[model samples]
Target: MKGVSTIQSFRVYKHGLKRLIQALGTEYVNLQNVYERLLVGIAPSHRIEAMIDDPFGELWREAQLLGRLRLRLWRSFKNFEDTVHDMREAVQEMMEKLGIGPDGEVEWIEHTSIRRQYKRVSFILQRSNYHDLLTRIREGVSSLQNMAIMNVNMESDRILRSQVRLNQLVNVTSNNIYHALRSTMTCRCQRLHEVGLRLTPPSRTIVPQDSDDDVIKELQFRLIISHMGPLATPSVRQWSEVLLQSARSQVREEPTTPLATKSSSSKKSVKFSVRSSVSSTNEFMQASAIIQPATATFSLGSAAMPVDSGMPQQIRDLCETMQTTEKRRSGDNCGHIQDHMSAKPSEYGVYFMDCLGDCENYVLVPLKDVLRDQSNGTLPPMLYSDKLRLAWVIACSVLQMQETPWIPSCPTHDDFYVVQKGGVPQYQNGFVLKHLPDRGGPGSTSTSTTSSARPTLLSLGIILIELILGQPLESLQPQDTPASQLSPSYEAANKFLGRVNMLGDLGISAPCNVVSVRYLKARTRRVS
Candidate 1:
């Protein structure tokens, strides 16, 4: 209700008081309201109006007021946003410093932060194009280095410089991203199994025995499969099957032949057919029935069987004693000591086979050394072929009696052609088996029984010659044996016995030219 001047003055005074409170106290003020407060501070005089009238002065005054208001608002939010940005940058820098992977992306493996937040940070980093960014950064660095070397004009270089700077910044940022990715990519898996991985071995420097390329390859396959991802190498299963089948083939024993004998071939085919048909059955039996008889025999000239001329007197003496006892007792008298002596059984015939190399085609043989098991414990025994048992010798031989007549026929008179003839020639080398009685004369009814028993025959004449002769059979005697049987002296017995059985089978023929004892001494010498 006062005059306009008086009302204005009072209003100005009220504005001044508000401005003072806003400046000195923690009161809030908006821009539009603050202008009145500023205007109130100005003296209500023509002097203030004169200053405002200057060029652009009114706009400047408004801007100043607006800026102050904006600054006040910005101050309130400053720490909240800046602190958040600083923490984010720190985390990103940490990720870059550590080398982890998805090669170029941040994997969760690297983090210094508390474990709980690592996965969360990694997820954010994954969305970043780490690889592309890093590539650009490297390109930018190259450009900067080139620009620095060229030193071009400012105007022209100015653009280049700006481009270089921008690229450098981009590159630096990208590098930081890449480093973060590398650190995070480190493997955090505690166990290989967790990742379905195996450990693959590196190549070895030394080779072991029997380690051929194929074998080494197979071993490598297995080792890699067990160590690395198991699914990566499946060749191991195929290799195992092949090795097993080869072992199975080696165990089958038969005379050496090119096509496995046709009969055996047929049998094998049949077995495969049967196996395919039923999957399981008596495969060996069915196969064996299909093969032809494995051996053959032939009859040569029927000669009179050899007689035991030396034992005739002993046999006669035993018969006489038995008769004398019966006569003295009239059927109840006991036999006298002489009668028992006459009845004493002679030791089984000790036949010899010519083992001399030249005498029987000089075939080399391999024999298994005998090992005796005793009740006390296993006695240490050396094998003939082993270095520890130098004194022992093992030899194998086969006797061909029909071809070599010097070999004497024994009680079991069946020819050896049935069991050995068709095999490899080496299998038919001369052998003298001992301890068989002489068979009865050919006309005897019991002769057939003796043939069924095992044959024990010898090339005793040829062996005696080797005993008498010091020279090897090949040089000193004929390959063929003498047709006529001759009685050998005790001197022959003393010869040809080194501690070892060099000529395993006695089919070895002795040289006819040497003295028996001399050959005997030679045989006694241990082979070095």
Candidate 2:
């Protein structure tokens, strides 16, 4: 009976020590959470989900917990430092009391099983200040709002670059034919008139008899056709040289010149300005008509636009308002959903990647379907299988369809999904939404499902390459594919595609670097 009593006493003491260890570990983790929140503030609920799913969060949390435990254990050493002189004696005494003979023999022990019970109690203690943490989290949400503003500011340069590239392409194409035909008009029309007279029957007067009214009508018709003729004619290949030179000049200079511009034209206070210079060569193109080449032209009429501008202004305003409201509501919804899930640090990275990819895929897939439907049977005879280019094209098409200049070119779709689901994606549809997750909080979402601008023409050129290559954006990773060889499928596709080149059909030729055999060979090797 005495021996049994001693064993039970030893077991009780061991259990208490284990509980203390678990409590210290849990407290350390809880403190870290509070510290991170204070440092970064609350993230948007969606962003929180992404962070919770990432491995970094888990690793960081564990590292912090273990670190605190180690620190606490070291502190205990200070109290027991005086006893270190008898450390071997104390360990032997404790081991003997636990009913183990001091043979100095090592044996496996189920420490994990013993530790499990302490975990439950420790968890309860860790969560005891839930209400206070909740209040702090609520207060910290503003940090994310500030982060959203910062993201917008940082991306402004990129957005402006896109706008400038698009503007350059449009201006080059327009000016090429505009000046080329200005001088040609006088001679070209007279030549046509002379030919028309020669074609008249010999029985008629030598100059071809016609009433004054008929003569005036013929001249008017010819003038109208000449002015509209440039709009329908294919662009001259020479224009690309001008375009190349202009792009080169842009690269060499930091800014053409800074010009004063207005600020805060709308509720969001979006700004626009031109601070670039045009070269003397471009001036010549603007001045001369025959020197310019006519390229493909697209109508800027309502038929080409994606959205109907005919909607009642009141309804349009309501839709915009609804979109903004819906985004906030969906963000809240995501927060609630994630609040119930296990928030262990180890699980964060995996969750973040998967959730983000799923959300992105969802938005993109729908846009693809919409494009496919809109194209009807007009899709190319030989379709390219490049998903990356397809994604960019879809993005551009969506932008091109928008009626407003404020719409983001590549707005994050996760934001759209959240807002649309919330049924409040009516307002603020043009702002590009970017989410930066806090340690473990909900991330931001978009307020508008619609964007009203298109991607730059340079993006279109990249898309063309992607389509011929039959690859994804991920393949562009630096380590994944060497620059020397990227796509082989393009070689096979090029033969069939050459018979009816999209670029040629569009009346433009890509630069030699972009279309060269050496580049294609390199791309082929890269794909393989």
Candidate 3:
């Protein structure tokens, strides 16, 4: 009777302890939710003024301090949650050993050894510091809860009252994008350097689809980007010189073995035949022109010619001539090319071998083309999720490449491209091609007053609207108003606000109601 009584007592105590721990965990989670909401609300304004040389330096400092405080509080709450979880587990295990069910019912064990184990476990539970620890955790959680509430209210008030300066926001957002790109290359040894990347028109290769579903599982843009050293700026002439020098060096390092001898003998026999069949420079140029413009329009039924089969004879001859030069320099280790190419920049340098092979395989089609095709019923309808994902990708890309050489000052749908493979567009593989600046042409460095005032942001908003409505920005022009008379900013703003008003009539039931509401609220707050 006494043993049964002891067992019942132990079960009750442990059950109570488990409940207390569970309650603490629930409180911690609620506190965490509050913290997350507060953070999200203030994120837009966070560090937004970092790039601007404004008088709000004190405000920026205060925001940073508050951000740090929130971080520290989150960490403290996480630790408390973990500790509470451990206590709950310990209490549950003690109860289970004593033959107590989850509902606090005791499983009567008649064996003497089992009864003795119950007593042992009960004694350990009593001696344990769980009670003191729970008390401390409860107190800590209470303190955190109070702090979280205070911060949340403080941030909410700030968000409601503060108005972001348009010009400052533009500069800061651009700077933020640059910083985001730099942060992505976490390795201190690597830096983001702009390089000229050329994209050729795509060639279709037919393949069987895994499923008949219209949804695109993945999209890839067939574009190439070269990374020079962190500090190395890209130069077309320098890149070509490096390539030529590397080829020469490779030739000099080749051993004069039996394989080399046979290869050279074979080359001598093929050289005369290649030269005899080579066409005139004018004929080769015409052939090149024919191939270059083939990318402008494509058909589902059309297939590209094989790269080597379509190579002009003159080009092949030039390649052979370069190879012959390399073989001739095989014995001359002290060549000028070696000395010139061996010189390194003060910072680390990584040279990539340029892909001068078949360009048809690396072609990229513009995003506008895909959108047009879809609208014209030439392609499958894009899923809502795909549209959302593409919008997110473009937004991030704008942030990363806004001030860089990769994108123009005001990028449109034309700047973004999609990779088409086997006549099917890879919608997921959309990318932006790097802008190749013309030598002595007007530089892209000069930012006009209008462009300096949130051009990227305006462009981004327009593109997003285009994606949502599955139409180009031009289509949104009011029928009565001539587009030529209005500035692009005014036109886009008028269209966007009109759409927001339409969404307001539809209430919160529309698919993009949340976005519309947020936009309207922000605008309203700014106006006030």
Candidate 4:
């Protein structure tokens, strides 16, 4: 009976192993298809060829390693499958040779042989390490997928910057009107150096078909300004010098025309020559004046501008003349101007400028204010789809700007703002504000240290939780806790997680409750 029981147990074990092998085969095929797709997607194309060249070789190397590991895993699985087949055949032979006793007991030798075979199979399974190999293959595939995503993001950023068309030669001192507007605003302002844009959308024109239908169309732009510190004077000077040198070179390359001389008509001819020379000189001067400002408005790079020591005086005089002209036009009127025509920079400082790109009728407002109004029941709750999209945008922003100076080490809700059109907040159009540290300000060092030490992921998790709960984490803290020893935010997260099931009662969907619980629990673990 014992021998029969052993044979039955071996048969069940063999069946289980066969199912596991089949499942692993299916997983391997699926993984291979995904891996092949990733390889093709990440291949260099004409649009992204420059972006993926030598600069991103690490990703290529990782892909190669993944392919090697996958091949090795396939080979190992095949060998394990063959070994399992051999074990099954041996078990069948041993069962066939079994001898039964009169009392319904099998031969001891056969039972011992089956026991030994089971032990051998167990040892071989442990030695195979098939589970570990599958785990590694899955991780490799995931890593490759993440690398592909990063590549796409980098290419998108490049395209976005190119489309924005930054005016590198913009005269900071002369463009003070933007600075004045920024100073008067209630929110903190910081320059977005990576994305400086000035866009003016083309206006629609209605051609007149009748005498009374004549109408003029003018292009309009919406200006968005942020305060900036002292301008990089050296960069500006270098740009001016290069422009002046280029103009001088062009003047030298032009050939001089010879004046006509005749004995009988010398007097008339000489007067005509003198008049023509004066007109030409005046035209050249006018052309230079017009070209300088127009060209400066479209120039794109500071690094490419060459320094010219010989033209320093000329460049200085030209800049000073332009500044004086701007001052005369602006006068002392620094008050708010309703029309773009009357707008002028204040005498205080320079400002960074941005403009709505193709967005006709929109204004920006603080996201914190929108949320507060929503909580007060003055505004409608955000749509679920918008919330999900906002979360995705925030996550992508963190990934892209983690190493950039524009993003703070620990970002909060206040760092984001929303777009409003016709008095309705567009939550999906939210953007993260840039950070600019005050120069030589008190506590700057300590603030930097503290922020650097804090985990940015934890802050992101808290922000996500707040979005899910539709309330600030601070508002959920227990009032009984003393302020002196309280970590209200962390405690609130823990409490929220503890009663996460209650979210369903408040009309929150089961999925949202699950997400909130996960975010809070992860946040709690990080805090501890």
Order of candidate numbers by TM-score, starting with the best: 3, 4, 2, 1
Query: Tens-digit lDDT track for model 1 on 294-385?
Result: 11111111111122223312122221222222123221212111111112211111111111211123222211111111112232332223
TM-score of 3: 0.41
Once fitted onto the true fold, the runs of candidate 2 whose alpha carbons sit more than 4 angstroms away are: 1-371, 374-488, 506-518, 521-528
TM-score of each: 0.13, 0.17, 0.41, 0.32
lDDT of 3 at 401: 47
| Model 4 lDDT tens row, 31-104 | 34433443444444442332222211233333333332222222232332233233223322322232212222
Sequence-dependent TM-score of model 2: 0.17
Candidate that would win on TM-score: 3
lDDT of 3 by residue, 334-396 (tens): 111111111231111112233322223434577777777777789887777667667766765
What lDDT does the true structure give each of the candidates?
0.24, 0.26, 0.39, 0.36
In angstroms, how far off is 480's CA in candidate 1?
Answer: 16
The predicted structure with the larger lDDT, 1 or 3, is 3
Output the worst ten-in-a-row residue range by lDDT, candidate 4.
Answer: 267-276
Q: Residue 208, candidate 2: how far off, in angstroms?
A: 67
- Give me the candidate number with maximum lDDT: 3
